[model samples]
Target: MAEVEDLLEGVTVRLSAAEEIRAKGRRRRARGRAVRVGAGGAALLAAAGAWMLLPPGDRGTRQTVATATANPFRTDGVIQMPRADELPGYARWHWTESAGLPAGAGRRSGPLPQVGLAEACPASFAMTDEPGQERYSLLYTGRDHALAQYRVIAYDDTATARSQVAKVREQMTECGLRAVPPTARESEEGSRAWSGTVQDGRTMRVTVRRWNSWVSVAEVLDGTPAD
Candidate 1:
C-alpha cells in the first residue's frame, strides 16, 4: 500500500509541472501581441505629426483650393486718364485734373459763320454732353513753350459715342475749322484734327478721338502768342 501511494504522489507532481509550463507559454504570447500593437500605434502618431509640421505652401492641393476661395477675379469698370509721364511729349510736364480753360475757350478769332454762336461748338465738344455722361480733364503745363489739355468723355453706349463724334464733325465744317490728318497718338475710330492761328497768332491744334463708348479730346498750343 505504501509503494502504491508513492507512485500516485509522483504522478500528481508531474501533472502540476506541465500545467505551470503551459501557463508561462500563454503569458509570453500575450506580451508579444501587446508589444506589436504599441509599435503600430506609435508609427501612426509619427505620421500625423509630420503632416502637421509641413509648410503652408507645401500643403499641396489643399492650400491652392483655399486660396482660390478667398479672392475672386474682377473686371475694371472705372475710366482713368493717362499719367503725366504717359503723354506723348515732354515727360516733366505738370498735370492737374479739371484744370485750365475749355478746349476752344477765348482762342477763336473770326468773321466765320458760327463765330457768335452758342457754346455748341466742335472745339469744346459740347455736343457730347448728356445726362449720364462722364467727363474728365487734365491740364498739362511746365514746358517753356507749350501748353496741353487732355479730356475724356464717357457715354452710356458705343452708338451714342459715334453719334456725338458725327455731330462734332458736322459742326466743325460749319464753324470753318478745316479737317487735318490726325497726329495725336490717341487717334482712333473718329479721329479728327483742326489747326489754325489763334487771336494772338499762336498755332493751336485740336484732335478728337473716339474709342468704343469713350471720347478723348487733346488740345495743344505750342509757342506763346506774341503780345
Candidate 2:
C-alpha cells in the first residue's frame, strides 16, 4: 500500500511538470509571433513614407505633371485642350518631374507630337498640368530662343485667371522665369499677339506668342478641386 501511494504521488508530479512545460512553450511562441508582426509593420510604414515624399514622376525616369481643372475637355476617356477663343487667353506650362538628371535636357523647339513623348530622350519628359487641378497648361520653348512659352488651357469660370497666373508666376520665378504680362509686342494689325493672362475661374494661365502656325506656348494648369 505504501509503495502504491508513493507511485501515485510521483504520477501527479510528472503531470504537473508536463503542464508547466506546455505553458512555457505557448508563451514563447506568442512572443516570437508578436516580434515578427512588429518588424513587418515597421518595414511597411517606412516604404509608404518614401513613396509619398519622392518627386511626382516615373521611378528613375524623366516625366512631367499636367494639372487640369474640372470640366476640362474630355472625349472617349481622353482630355482635349480647348481653343483659346472658347476660354480666352489661357495657356499652359510644363515642369519636368523626374529624379536623376535627364538625358536630353537642352534647347528643344517646334511643337512636339501631341500624344506620347519621343524615345530618343529616354528621360526628360514635359510635365503637363495634372487633370486634378481647376486649371492647367502645357509649355514649349524654342531651340534658339531664351524665352520659354506656354499655353494656358482651363475650363474654370471667367474670374480666376489672374490668381492662376500669380500662382504660376510664383512657380516660374523659382525657375528664373518671369511672367511677361500681355503686351502688344508681336501684334500685327487685326491678327493680335496675346501675352496677357486670362482667368477662366479655373485659375490658370498660358505663356502665349504668335509666329507662323506654330505658336510658342506654355501653360499653367490650376487645380479645380482636390478629390
**Candidate 2 on 1-227: residue-level lDDT in tens?**
11222366456322335567689899999999999999999999999988878876544333211322233244575545444332333233223322221234333322221111112121223453432223234333221111222332442333343343333444434333334445453232112221222222233333543222222334333432222
* The candidate that achieves the highest lDDT relative to the unseen native structure: 1
Q: What shift in Å separates residue 43 of candidate 1 from its native position after superposition? A: 77
* Displacement of the residue 33 alpha carbon in candidate 2, Å: 2.8
User: Residue 52 in model 1: shift from native, Å?
Assistant: 68
TM-score of each: 0.45, 0.24
| Deviation (Å) of 146 in candidate 1 | 3.6
RMSD per candidate (Å) reads: 19.1, 18.6
| Candidate lDDT values, in order | 0.55, 0.36
